[model samples]
Target: MSIIKKLASQTAIYGLSSIFGRFLNYLLVPLYTYHFSAAEYGVVSEFYAYAGFFAVLLVFGFETGYFRFRDKNDPQRDSAYSTALWFVLGANLVFLLLIRLVRTPLSEALHYAHHPEYVEWFAIILGLDAIASIPFARLRAENKAFRFAGIKILEILVTVGLSLFFIAYCPPLYAKNEQVWFAPIYDPGIGLGYVFIANLAASGVKFVLLTPQLKGLIWGFDRVLFRKMVGYSLPMVVIGFAGIVNEMLDRALLKYLLPHDPLMNMRMLGIYSACYKLSILMSLFIQAFRYAAEPFFFAYADKSDARRVYADVMKYFVIFCMAIFLLVTLYIDFFQYFIGREFRAGLGVTPILLLANLFLGIYVNLSIWYKLTDRTLMGAFVSLGGALITIGLNLWWIPHYGYVGSAWATLACYAAMAVVSYLLGRRYYPVAYDLKRIAFYIAFGLGLYFAREPLLTYGYRSWQAGTLLMGSYLLSAALFEFRGLFHFRKKLPAGDSGKSLGPGRK
Candidate 1:
């Protein structure tokens, strides 16, 4: 129980920082949507969709590989770290060179021929970020939650501050012939390019701050360790690329398959992308949980009650995700204002995408089975299957249903992945997950959401009805789980302080 408490604390630190940082970044959604047309913003969205693939590709899953190999106090720990770090650094260097060589033709192929610089900037951004992942992973391994959160927040601040300076401040000043000193740096022609520049600068700042973690590089790479880590992590790369396909392929494919003119397709993509931001809370929580939970799981793997802890974690994760789903869907009237008017047309997809993200979070939790059991190849198979589902559905649906089709496709992909992962997990590394309670929470949340419209017939305002439904759900959850939570806590063995399995303990 103490271990669970520590995990919660780490998760809280990571989760709160992520929520705040991403919320700050989330503010930029309104800025972009308001300032740029849907067509213009779609270019930014498309580039980022491609970035997701390379982000996975360049790192080659070495972050998790390092965690797997660098166990506490192992003689080869430093070797594992250095080998993984050097390998990633070398790979990214080659990746950047390739991007440079192909930037022109690649930009032309992507329909951004006039601004091949976009390709160049993103290559550097992704390379820097991939290099930094190992250090971030090391932080998780070490349980340095505060430092990790601080650095993450700092990066977000840099990105958000620079974005505001370039997009919001500079253009108005340049137009009025004011701030002449800043004039030389500001380029109105850059337009949406400013967003990418802000992100690139942020990645650079994060990379610089992580230089201390690069000290491991001096240990030199080990051929044996490098080969082993690569063997383990290659499947992770496949899993990651497939995961990207599941998450981003819709945005990537929308423009090509929309059955509309190029510009209109971009317009629809922009609207869909903007509304997708409404799922930020779900995505951000999952990300923060992943940061904390991955290390926690590895560290706690030998514990007698680890499976129980994992099951509890899954239930609570579902509860919280359902809460986020309802929070966004029920109060959508307020959340809709977060994007500009043009993007509001795609708001109907918000609940679908949010639920999809919820399922993705579940899959992320369930995936620990394969990671722990060294069955990553099986994980790859599941993710690849989901990716294929996403591709086929988007190809068939986008032509008929437009962006809404993409939304449903995402939900279908994630839900299918979660189910498949869960079934496979039971076979290889069973955790008696509380499926009934999990299902109840999900069904209850959805029931409340659907009940909202019917309840409005009673003359209650949307806000009032939403508040009442949310309150009811909270009360039911508390009533059902309070006793179980307390019982678990009471059963903790005497003298168990529940501190983290620190550096050498694991």
Candidate 2:
């Protein structure tokens, strides 16, 4: 298959798990919004934000390490796998013990001293997830997309079921019948505790699903290969830490910078998070694209025309991502209802956050140059720049603008990284990306987005306005690129079968 077709297939499978899984998980937004106060949900959001950081720490970038080493025709593939597994397992064990020892102090530090179990159980969840990362990466390396999708979907299902049972059904059942099982553990007052427990259950299920990947493997650790993988992966640890901090530090810092009232501050955070879910429509596409693109890029890195392919991929990526951005933003009037009515007030941040994700996707594509060239330290530097931008912006703006500041921080940080990566990639490994064409698409999308309000004033409902905006963009693209769309099955000339038309070529 061609790269585009292969990407489409993999993206469909991965998107099934991600889009549907997130949709199912999104049900929790409304569930929590209705059941718990905004502040309570904020606690859940803030805690998970911190969990994101710890997750990167515990895994220590071995997932990417697996991808990097698995590509080599080493005699010690099994040994490499086993070594990476044991390394993460050892780190997770030590981290768990340390968390246990410092549980009190950590709880006190986070202002969750009254609910230290949140810290404890969260540590367990992150530890299990970290250990599970090895087998998960192996699945990707081995091309087990179906199994990957199944396991992911199953995990989401289990999490949703448990969450509903605890938060929605259990309380009333306990009130009506004290003999009900699991009632004591289902404390309604501990709003965020249920979220943690659900995550723990889901992570456990993931471990079980990965049992097949773990079996029949040599558990013996190879110190030499271990050292090599660690050398390759350690930089990634810094990159991953910085990358996650860029994404999450705003939420974590919000609690500290905001007022002392945990409940009130968390409520504000919850609103931000709930609306943020709406932005995931764009993010999910970017994630699925990355899942397929990374492996494909690395596999094709040696092709003579790989640079052209990379450039084409970036153009198409921006086109589709911008389309998604427009779709979500134009029709947010409908999607915002996914969260509760009370939380809809934060919908103002959706466009800003969506643009941030778009920039983030672009940066990911740009960073591939560094990854392929083995100059991953450059990636660390880029992400560190982004992290600094995120922190600096949050500190300056969150105090004045609240969650809106978080939105701006995300946008500014990602835009800076995207610009920097493009500049640096040109210096290190240039690809002729269609910056002019991509900018036209973005400008067109933004113009359509802003014109929606005027269109709606003419008796068009929001959904109708959205449909027209999306349809216009599609029609314009089709008109301008009709040959590219229609010539998919066109045969090459009789004497030139090996040569084919390039992107945007007639």
Candidate 3:
């Protein structure tokens, strides 16, 4: 219970950036959906999807490798940080140069020869972000959560400010009076491209914000350590690539797999992506928790009671995810308004995707077994299996059901991976998780969600039903974990043994 409190505290600090900062970023979704056509927004979503894959390639998993080797294996290690930083820096440099050469050909292949600037801009943005990865990871490694949250918030502000300048403020001013003071930054022809440009500008600012990380740091590269670290972390790249497949492949694949024309296909993709953002609350929590949990888990791995702590964390994680699932799905009528009217038709996929993200978070937590045991290749295999499921299902289903099929495919992939990871993890490194209780929590929350629509017309209101469902569920959880929640201790008679019984696990 104490350790869980610590984890929750850290997650809250990290959430300032992940949830709050991204909430500010989420404002852009409505802005984009309202201003640009669905086809235009889809292009932005598709390019960012490709960026997700490239970002993984750029890091090659050195961030986790740094955490494992420097912090856990050899706490006194001095050069691991510099070694990882320089290696990724050089890799990103090479990537930037390579992209410069193929930018034209790549643009033409993507039917964007006329706007190769998009490809050129994103390559630089991705490369710069890749180089910044280690500095950012260093903050996490050192438990510098506030610094991290601050820099991330600043980055989001840059993005939002630039986007508004170009998309909202500058356009009308430029049209009515081209000589206005801020008119030069606006270009109506750019359309959805401002979104990418805003991203590029903000990414550049992230480097500047993190410049202080370079001080008091060793830049000297250790060839031997670099080689060893890469050897260990290389398999993580596969895991990361597969993870991206589960996340972004549907958007990329929908273009060619669907029978519709390119424009119409993009429009449908845009609709799905917009609605997908509506389900991001669960993912937001997972991201925040991951940032805090990964370092905490690794740092505490050597403790004798670490497995018990991990088990408790898992139970609490599922409980919170289920709560979030109900929170969003129960009030989805309002969330769908975050997207344009055309996009709201796909709101049915939100709950499916939300559950999928919950499973993904579980898989992430389970992945620590492989990370701790250094059996990272097993993690790679699990992710690869999930990737295959993602690819096969998206290919077969997209033609028939479009993006809705993709949503269900994501849920299936994550759920399968979670089960496989748990089974394999227990075989190799058993943790006595209270699976029955956790399963009941998930099932109960889902039952409440499913019961919402049916009761809507039977004199039940959403808020009223939501309050009843969530309130009762919380009370049930409190009673189930009363020992921890209430911290009850037995009363002893005066002068009697002077010892009191503490709370017991139910």
Candidate 4:
């Protein structure tokens, strides 16, 4: 198969987990928003925002580091895996210990002193998740996409199932009988803590399920390779921490910056975060693609047409992302129902956030250059710049215009970051990206999004306008830009019309 075809197939496989699993998890948004007040949901949102920061720190760029080094020591690829695994494991244990030492004070500082267990739950969740990172990366590197997807699906199933049982089922059961069979497990006062507990359980189960991947592992560490991996991955610490800052600092800053009661501030943030799920479709695709693309890019780096494959991946990624943008934005009236009505007030930010996510995805694609060229320091600089933009603007905008300002800040930060990454990538490890087509798709997608209101003015239902616009956009894209991919050749004996570039399989 062609590299693009392989990428598409693998993305689909990973999507079975990343995309579908997230979709299943998406059900939790409704459950949470419905079960908890916007303010309560805000507390949940804030902790997860903090979780994003720690998650990045706990893994400390080892996922990408493992990818970069795996091929270097091909004779013992497991050396890279084992070293990366041990490095993250040690870091997580220390980090969790430190959290244990300060859990109460840390919880108080975050204004969650009433529920310090949040600290303990997330500490364990982050540690287990960080340790699971290498094995998941190994699955991708080994092209075990199906197995990866399966475990991922199972994880989400357990998470979502338990969340529903706790938040929805147990309460009614207890109401009927406080002496119910699961009484010990159910606590109504704990409220949103169940969300964290469910997530913690799911993450722990995933870690256990990955025990097979951990077996037969050598315990000895290579000091030289360890230093090299650290040298390569240390910069990722900045890049990742800063990237999370860009992605999540708004929610964090909003809690402190909003001129309202603590609960009110959380309400505002909850609203922002809930509506932000409107862009979850794009978010899901980016995740699935990232899961597959990182290892794919590393593995294909030495290909005769590596640059060409990278370029194709970039163009196609934009095409699909743009398509998602139009589809989601046009139909957001329905997606708005994913959150409660109080949160839907922030739906105006959805389009902007969707575009921001699009740019972020492009930034991730452009990032392959730095990863491949071992220019992680440059990547760190770029992410630091983006994080500064995110912070400065949130500090400036939240007080003046609320979460809308944060939304615009997100877009501006990512747009600036994408341009900066592209420019630096060209200078360092250039790929001839199709800028004109990318610009056209984005412009066209935005144009269609802006037209949604006008179409709705004609009294068509939101879904009707959405479907009509989506169809028109797809048909137009096909006629003008995607027609060539439509042409087909007679099947060869082996089914691939393109020249077989490797050893015969049959």
Candidate 5:
């Protein structure tokens, strides 16, 4: 099969889990938004932002290391795996111990000293998830895409099911029969804490399900292999850390930089976070694309025409992402219903964030230049630059503008990285990406978007207005650039006909 076809198949399978899993989890947005106040949901948002940061640390770039080294034609693949496993295991153990030892200080730092249990539980959860990551990467490398997708879907289903039962169903049952099983442990006042417990339970179940992958693996540690993998993966650690900080630093900083009330600040964050989830469709596509593209890129890196293929891939990637952005923004009046009424106030940021995510996806496509060339340190530098820009913008803007500042900070950070990478990649590796044509498409889409508001003032229904705008954009592409829309394959003439047409094959 062609590489593109193979990638599409794998992406479909992986996206099944991601799309459906996200949709299922998406249900929780309404549940949480309805049940908890914006402030309460903000706690959930803030904590998970920390989770994203800590997760990058716990995995320590071993996932990328596994991918980089697993293809080596050596007998030490198992040794590499074991070495990475042991390194994370040791680090996680030490991390957990340290957190436990300083639980008081940690709790105080988070201003949740009364809830040190939250810290303790979160620490254990992070540790388990970190250790599980290497094996997960192994699954991806081994092309066990089906198993990987299934486990992921199963985990999401279990988590969603438990959360619904606890938050939506359990309260009513307990209210009617106070003497029912485990009544003492159930507290409706705990609010967002139930979300955490459900996550812990689901994560534990995934660890159990992944035991088959763990079984029968040799467990011997190799110091030499460990050193090599660390050397290779350390740059990726910096890259991952900086990349996540660029994405999440605003959320972490907003609590302190914004106004005084913890509850109000959290509420604003929650509103922003919920509205941000609307962009998950684009994020999900990029994620599935990356999962397929990474290994495919490495495998094809030595091919003579690889640069052309990369250029084609980027063109299509930008096309599809822009298409998604248009769809979301054009129909946002309807999409706003995904969150509760309180969150609708933050809907203004959704379009801005969606565009930022599109830029981020483009940046990921451009990043292949560095990865395939073994100039991975370039990625670290690019991400660090973006992170620094994000921090600076948030600090400068958040005090004055609050959540709007965070939104602009995110947009600026991603736009900077995408443009910077494209310029640098052209100098270093030089893929002839259709930048002029892509920019035209973006400009046309934006024009269509801005024009829609004025057109809607003429008494069109919301859907009618969106449909008109989307159709206009499509029609514009078809008319002005229809040749680019067509896919043609050249064919050879039949035996005798080939001879007749040999000199002038048209």
Candidate 6:
């Protein structure tokens, strides 16, 4: 329990950036949806969907690899860090050069020949982010959560500031035909492209700020260590690629899979993407938890009680996720306003996507078994299976149901992945996850959500009904789970005269 508290504290600090800073960036969803047409926003969404795959590929999973190899007191930790850092930098540099060579052909193939700069801009963004990932991983390994959070927040601040200046402020000023001081840089022709430019600028700023951590390269690379790390981390690339396929393949495919014309397909994709942002609350918490829990899991794995600790963490994670699930679904009327009126038609997918992300978070917790046991290949196999499911379902259903089918496909993929991971962990690295309670909470939260429509006829307003449901779940959770918090310590056996039982035990 104490260990869980430490993990929670670290997550909270990281959340200062992940939740708050990203919330600032998350606000841009509305800005784009309101200011741009659905088809225009779809252009931004599709490019990012493509960037997601490259983001995973260029890193080569070295972020996790670095954490796996570096420990607090290891004499060779510097060699491990230096090896990973230099390798990632080299890989990203090669990637950028390749992008430079092929940008024209790639842009033509993607129907962006007139805007080849989009390809170059996104390529640079990906390379910069991949290079910066190693330093960020080092901060986690070293328990420098404050520094980590500060840098992350700084990056997002730059993103938000530039986005507002280009997308919101500059447009009106340029439209007025005013000779503004910033006129030299503002290009009205960029239009929706401003979003990508803002992101590229943010990545550049982050890379510059991370220069101090780049000093690890002075330790010099180790050829032998690099091979071992790559051997271990390469399978993680498969896992990550599969994970991206599960998450983003829908957006990438939607523009092709829809039965409608290309323009309408893009408009539908834009609406789907806009509603998808409604799940940001759940995604934000899971991300912050991952940042804290990944290193914490590796460091604590040697302890005898680590499995018990992981079990406790899993239970608490599910509870909080269920709370998020109910919060979003019950008050969805309020969240719907976050996007433009044009995008509100797809709001039905919000709950489906939120539940899907909840399952993904559970899989993240279950994934510790493979990482700690060095069975990453098995993890890769599980993720591949999910990816197959994602691909097959999207191909089959997208033509018929459109974006709604994509949402359901996502839910199905994550749910199957989580269940499979839990089953595999039981065989290879078992933890006594409280399945009964976890299932109960999920069912309970869904019940509250579905009951809202019928209960609205009974005289309560939507908000009033939502408040009652939210209060009921929270109160029930406190009483059912935290009853142990109030337990009095029992006396030790008479024969145990000189020994203490444990913390919180008498």
Candidates in descending lDDT order = 1, 6, 4, 3, 2, 5
Candidate 2 pairs with clashing backbones: 38-267, 39-267
Candidate 6, residue 222: the lDDT equals 92
Residue-level lDDT tens digits of model 3 in 1-506:
57789899999999767888999899999999999888888888899899999999999999888887774445344588878878888889999999999999999999888899899899999998988888888898878899999989989999999998889988887888878886566667886678889989999999998888765256578889888898889999999999999999999998788789998999988999998998788989999999999989888776666787788799999988988898888877678779888778788889999999999999988887788888889899999999999999999899999999999999999999999999988777677778998899999988888788777878788778777777877888778787654542244234442112211121
lDDT of 2 by residue, 1-506 (tens): 27667767887788878899888888888888888888888888888899988889898778888777773565335676777888888899999999999999999988878999999999999999898888887777766878888898899999999999888888888889888888657676765688888989999999988887775256678888877788778788888898888888888888777655766677788888889888888888888877777777877776656776677778778888888989899988788878888799999999999999999999989987678777788788888988988888899988888889989999999999999999888877777888898899889989999999999999999889999999999888777666764663465344442223232111
Lowest-sum lDDT 10-residue window in model 1 = 497-506
Model 2, residue 168: distance off in Å is 0.5
> What is the total number of backbone clashes in candidate 4?
0
CA lDDT of each prediction against the hidden true structure: 0.90, 0.83, 0.86, 0.86, 0.80, 0.90
lDDT of 1 by residue, 1-506 (tens): 57767878888999999999999999899999998999999999999999999999999989999889995886334788889889999999998999999999999999889999999999999999999999888888888888999999999999999999999988888888865788778888898899999999999999999999889898898998888898899999999999999889999999899999999999999999999999898998899889989988988887766777788899989998999999999999999999999999999999999999999999999998889988888899999999999999999999999999999999999999999999888777778788999999999999999999988898989899999999999999998899878886799777553333221110
| lDDT over C-alpha atoms for residue 282 of model 5 | 90
RMSD of each: 3.6, 3.5, 4.5, 4.4, 5.3, 3.7
lDDT of 3 at 278: 86
**Model 4 reaches what TM-score against the true structure?**
0.94
Worst 10 residues of 3 by lDDT: 497-506
Preferred candidate (lDDT higher): 1 or 2: 1
What is the per-residue lDDT of model 5 for residues 137-237, given as tens digits with 9 covering 90 to 100? 77776778888888888888888998898898878888799887868778877656789888888888888888876642566677877777787788787
lDDT, residue 297, candidate 4 = 87
In terms of TM-score, how similar is model 1 to the real structure? 0.96
